[model samples]
Target chain A: MSSDPNSTSNAAAKPADGLNDVHTLSLVVRDRPGVLVRIALVFARRGYNIGSLAVSPGAAGGFARMTITSQGNPETLEQIIKQLAKLVDVVHVADHLEHPPLEAEIALVKVGVGEGSDRNQALHEVALEFNAVVVDRGKATSVLRLIGSRDELQAALSALAPFQVQELVRSGSVVMDKGRSVLTDLLQKS
Target chain B: MKASVDTGAQRLIRFLEHAGVEYIFGLSGGAAMPIFDALVDSRIKLILTRHEQGATHMADGYARATGKPGVVLVTSGPGATNTVTGLLTALMDSVPVLVLTGQTPTFNLGKDAFQEADVTGITYPVVKHSYLITSAQELPRVVKEAWHVLTTGRPGPVLVDLPKDVTQGPCDAPEPETIDIPGYRIPSLPDTEALDRAATALGQAKRPLLYVGHGAVISGAGEAIAALSDKLQAPVVNTLLGKGAVDETGPLHLGMLGMHGTAYANKAVVACDLIMSIGGRWDDRITGKVDAFCTDAVRLHVDIDAAEFDKTVTSHIQLLGDARRTVEALLPRVRPGDTGAWLAQCQAWREQFPLTFESPDDDHLRAQHVLSRLNALTEGKALMTTDVGQHQMWAAQFCLTRANRMWLSSGGAGTMGYGFPAAIGAQFARPDTPVWAIVGDGGYQMTLCELATACVHKLPVKVLIINNNYLGMVRQWQELFFENRLSGVDLEGNPDFVKLAEAYGAKALRISHPSEIDDVLSEAIAYADGPCVVEASVVKEDNVFPMIPAGAAVSEMLIERPTEKLEKPSGST
Candidate 1:
């Protein structure tokens, strides 16, 4: 299941409360073999439920950044952060619950309008309202690509539901700070 | 080429020799042939074990005994899989052990080649850090990094998986001048502000208690703990693994608190107003009911691992640093509280409920009696290691230890089959010291294969097997909590251990009566030419007392067996 977009909005969640509240943790780690497995094992060992995980090469060489959405007790999450920081390959771990980071997700949806111009025109207006672009068009089906916050993507999907949505695929949330500060800045000081 | 270059295996051996490693406990197999051959010309002696698990336990024992990183080298697949238990054992106790396992050639890594296994994937959860080496040039750096990670702050096990092709390939890489591990940091002195607060809490405390754990032993904080105890006029209690961190013979010391601990130690924990924990996590065994464990006490926790703070039980003051350094820093800042009445109350409890057992007027001997006699004979001078069981708890109660590292047991992991092999490792670490392995009948059978290793090396390790023909600890639980419905606790058709040890070329003796304990133990101890075995046939169903039932509060401890018999569930026999 995709992570709930509303969980990160509430910064005042108490420790050991709301076991199902999703948490977003960003980790900067060394680009070494088995680093991903090492990081994943830390979550699995603690029985924390990971909703979605994304990893990509870092801006600098010999490094990688990972975004993980998991749900567990906040107290246990604090211990999990400490355990992650203990890993030799893990450089930094930042939880986005306190200061919600700038996050976005992209989704592609294919809808069938049933060979009617009126329904096709209605789908186009719905796409326009949600700022989605038509990526492909067929006689009775059309594909639309949407990029926005998780809530926006949900609204767009619901708006297109009347047109017989055939398929949908989504890229998990990617995040960054609102300012110029980089996570790797901590690396230089250490 | 100007000259013949060294293979990766040869270079690894050379690096280990340069690192001052004296022994490598390993079992050789197909994929590990190159490394085994490379050791032919090296100064580090290799102790071949009967099983890979035995080899790992031996290395763990050596590390615990000497405070040096114990090294192990083994083959792929089963060899690598078997070391998982030993690695977890060391990891749970914060012991430093470096394991080197051979893998299939790089091309056959994920293809499921013969004798191939995903070494790093299999061991990631248990190890502190691991490496899967694909190229020969990475050996120097990996070896240095693994050693550094294993022996540094919050020491634990580290693994290096070397593919066969990588080790067989040629290498000429130079050793790095410095270890560049940026993410790995060793905590220095703790903040003075936290120390000041902890000292103030101690100053205000009327009934203070010093709770010692393995961290105190690891950081050599025993002298400081004693100084703090005397300065505050506070009584001291140790966790199971924390037994030898401070001298148990001292009057201020209450030996081993928690489940199966002394009643007086648990009583002191209940009465103390402030509890200062040094190097010991608030494990479930010690804090039986966390909410009720010293609820009124002001908690001060000092440890090197920051993750342990507020993990199970929240503390008011957290000092994150080496235990010795933090305690030493707090010494001058602390003001002694007036604890004369508190100390007298604890001493009265100690006198009222001292650790004792019934010397029954019968033919059968008791495990507690055997251990108490052993303690008297050794005079708390021997290095004692025990496997997990009722015998282990009895040994912890009766066999007093005098210094750090003097008593080693599988505390956190509760691993059976750990004692004999660990005794072999300890004997190697301290060749002149008296090494003893106090084991149960069940656990001794798990690692008795190592008897050959001890005999071959002529190591003077004494193995005392408390043979009661049952898995004593499990049977005790079934009898107490399960209406005496004994299921798989019986060990029927067991081989005679005396004959078994003799078959392995060890001097073996069997003693069944209490009167024979001193003579049999003296005979075994005097037989110093090689390893000796003494199988004491003890009472079959005796259980360890002063027990706090699992998940029960410390106040709910059963100081003795229930006087009434439990009613068995109705069934047709």
Candidate 2:
């Protein structure tokens, strides 16, 4: 652990190596009112900031699948997972720490294209390299939608940063096991 | 076939009756009128309290005493808000309480109508779970689910907010045959491999200590703990709420451990080679300076809540299950340790540093003396409840609780106004047993209005007030750590407690001198016609000793007042 108390950098602030590592947690929860607030409160109370979150109705009836990304000490994250599991609305909590699930995210990047031919050509080249498709093209701006892994999306955004990027929005990472087993299978067996 | 219809309020009351709820503690308000009216014809008795906070504490006390989920009913807005403290008290202590709060009509919920408040939102963090009923048809399912959630798997408080429109509306909904909470799971058995490891650790340790907590008391693990202690020849020290987990009078039992704990108990914690904590979280109060607490000991923690494992202090072996069941399972697999030397050392410490106070020549009563006398007079049989601060610690030191659920205090939240009302609740739960509320002058004034509730209900609870004209605990800290620079600790111009009790129609007594302690306590205990108040005017500036200053380790415990200036310990904010 770094003894420098003033260090705000994640690595120095954390007590142990990989303590500040970002983690994605998948939860299968009941489709009940206030379930989101309860789950969010669990993170908020522990001072763990959620980097991103995405939720949708689960394939299993009367349930919801939630994907939350947050960064904190792994010891504290273990406790957070246990606390989340204790919630009555939460069915299962899967921390993608050991298994390292297959993760993906989507981003819509709106860039200024009418600046010049050179800049526009450069943006198109970057989009092609990242396999991003032009979803909307306006007179001066073009919206490119990219679907890939989180790192790929980040690389694509960095590659397109020089073309006067106007606005960028990215969906939070969603994950699944890279095997035949399903996350919702436990619900059926229980 | 035609189904008969009833209003939501009627259905709620019927559900309570079906669940064998004997009492509901609450105050009436406009939004809850329908439910109150429905209660008029129900079998469950309603005990009206002066304040909603008192009602919640009463319910908490009742739950702690009876091991049944206590029920609370109050209106929306302020009524719901007032129960926050009591709910927090129950939540921190893991008491099972069900709070039913009235809400404004569903349409007016977000509009901020009269007597409106976001009750579920405000109480979200404190409750085990909560519900907001928008339709009368949902009452049956919500009530049953609420009870199930409140009573199972580490019991805690749950709230159900009812909108007035829903309660007044007609309902013909059928009760669910079985509760369908698939997400909730209760662990009944501990992992056998983990228990075997723990038993092995216990067998190898020459010096092992059982650090019990409220979980043991809640799980009724007294006999099992006693058995384990006897088999291993280990000494037992308990947390404040863990008072009755084992017989305090037993030869191997040490009193409460931590700040204001017995000196010998704290010493045992520091000296033990192996410590097994059962049903008790390693609270900051118990483990001062967590890194330094029991550092050399091999920790074995047993608790139903998995989140508590390695929460504050890491345990080498974590046994996840109910306290009683886990201990019973480990009994057959365990071999007794050779701890004769350790037992002798602990016993020697107990004799060398007994819990005692000096007798002043001025004849003014010492709070410690008064409490010891009360314990002797009651013969350790009375069900004792206490408010927070100096008197609370004194009571925990002197009062001998022999069985589980006999000692009830606000351990986690330490809410001051808890004692009198809790005693009332305990009286209601165990009508045959005598209940005593040991309170301080400052804490007694917080909820003294409950004197009316006790008088009206004719409860035979004895209220013993250790009247020192200051917030004794804070004042002690100010004098010791703050260079005697007093701030807001004084309680001057206080009303005469005897007169105040009389105004509330309660029998009152007073003891100003040391000679009057026995006579006054005897009179108050003998007066069983109604609630009685005995205010003992104790010496001011008296401090509780055997204290580990906040954030200081067990090594820093002070058995007496320091004659020189004191320095703040490290890691204390």
Best by lDDT: 2
Off by over 4 Å in 2: A1-14, B1-4, B360-362, B569-573
User: lDDT (0-100) at residue B288 of candidate 1?
Assistant: 79
What's model 2's overall lDDT? Answer: 0.90
Clashes of 1: 0
Give stretches of model 1 more than 4 Å off: A1-15, A180-184, A187-190, B1-3, B564-573
Candidate 2: residue A161 Cα off by (Å): 1.0
Measured with C-alpha atoms, the lDDT of residue B548 in candidate 1 is: 84
User: Whole-model Cα lDDT per candidate?
Assistant: 0.88, 0.90
Candidate 1 RMSD to the real structure: 4.6
Give lDDT tens digits, candidate 2, residues B1-573.
Answer: 134568999999998998889999999999999999999999899999999999999999999999998999999999999999999999999999999999999989899899899999999999999999999999999999999898888989999999998898888889888988778999877888999999999999998999999999999999999999999999999999999989998999988899889999999999998899999998878988776788778888899988788777777788999999999999988899799999999999999999989974457689888899999999978999999999999999999889889999999998999998999999999999999999999999999999999999899999999999999988998898888899999999889999999999999999988888889899988888999999989999898988888888888888888778887655443
Q: Top model by DockQ, which number?
A: 2
* Pairs with backbone N, CA or C atoms under 3 Å apart (clashes), candidate 1: none
